[model samples]
Target: MGSRRRTPYGPGNPGASLTVHPLEGCRGIRAAGEVGLATHTIWEGVLEQAVREGEDVYYLELSEVTFVDVAGAGALAAAAGRLGAGRRLVVRRPPPALRRTLEAFWPGLPAIEVTM
Candidate 1:
């Protein structure tokens, strides 16, 4: 798997970084680091790529991710919304707050499935 890294600085947070790695045996990505305003572009880009891949199920393995803001979670939900019927985004081991944010704002959304 190839690894790509991005570091975007935001106010009061200079150490912000996000790394995305292609999964070895699946059509998905595993991400690490923080997802905030500064790193959202990369986050959105990955999500868009997943959507364009047109797979029945796309995986986002985020167990190593440390933080995800509301907007980041919103971006994920939006990406899932773009999928065609019977397709879904499978989020694995995402941060608890990210899952809460998804449930709080986009309750019962069918296109996104979260697994701990």
Candidate 2:
């Protein structure tokens, strides 16, 4: 297992960081912390990397994710849309905020599947 990287968000609060770590026994990663303007880029990069790595199915465990802003939600939606044929982006146990954000902003997105 790899170590967790702390990615700081926003300009002023350098102390506030997001923890991103690789998921064990799966072709994906888990993110814990706030997903905002400063941290959304990290999410996009991770998503693209997962796609590039040829993972037929990508998983993102967002149960520990504290918050999701508009840009963060967009990033997730875009990542889901980028999957190729027979590929999927499974979101496992997403937090209520993330679920509600997806439901309110992007209803009926075929690529993103939410499981309990």
Candidate 3:
């Protein structure tokens, strides 16, 4: 498994950061840190990688993520939308607001499954 890290500068928010690590024994990733305006690009890159993997079930283990903004959740939904039929993205332990944003804006999306 490989590891990547991105720390984007945010005005008055030096802690804005994101790290993506490939999941062992699976075609997926485990991400940590905050996903907001500053870290969106890295977040999207991680999602893009997941899509490129073309696995039937892509897992996003985000239990360690401190926060995820609405746009970040939107990006996740958009990435899941790109998957082929019968393919899905499993989102594990996301932030509460991020989960709500996904549920509110993209209810019943077939390609995304949220789990605690």
Output the number of the lDDT-best candidate.
1
Per-residue lDDT for 13-114 in model 1, tens only?
Answer: 577878898988989999988888678878888999999999999999999988998888989999999999999999999999899999899999999999
How many residue pairs clash in model 2?
0
Clashes of each: 0, 0, 0
Please give the CA lDDT of all the candidate structures: 0.87, 0.75, 0.84
TM-score of predicted structure 3: 0.89
User: What residue runs in model 1 are displaced by over 4 Å at the alpha carbon?
Assistant: 1-8, 11-13
lDDT by residue (tens digit), candidate 2, 18-109: 57788889888888776666666677777787677777788888888767777777888888778777777888888787788899988988
The residue-level lDDT of candidate 2 at 25 comes to 94
Off by over 4 Å in 2: 1-14
Ranking by lDDT: 1, 3, 2
lDDT of 3 at 96: 89
TM-score of each: 0.91, 0.81, 0.89
TM-score of predicted structure 1: 0.91
> What is the model-wide C-alpha lDDT for candidate 1?
0.87
Prediction 2 global C-alpha lDDT: 0.75
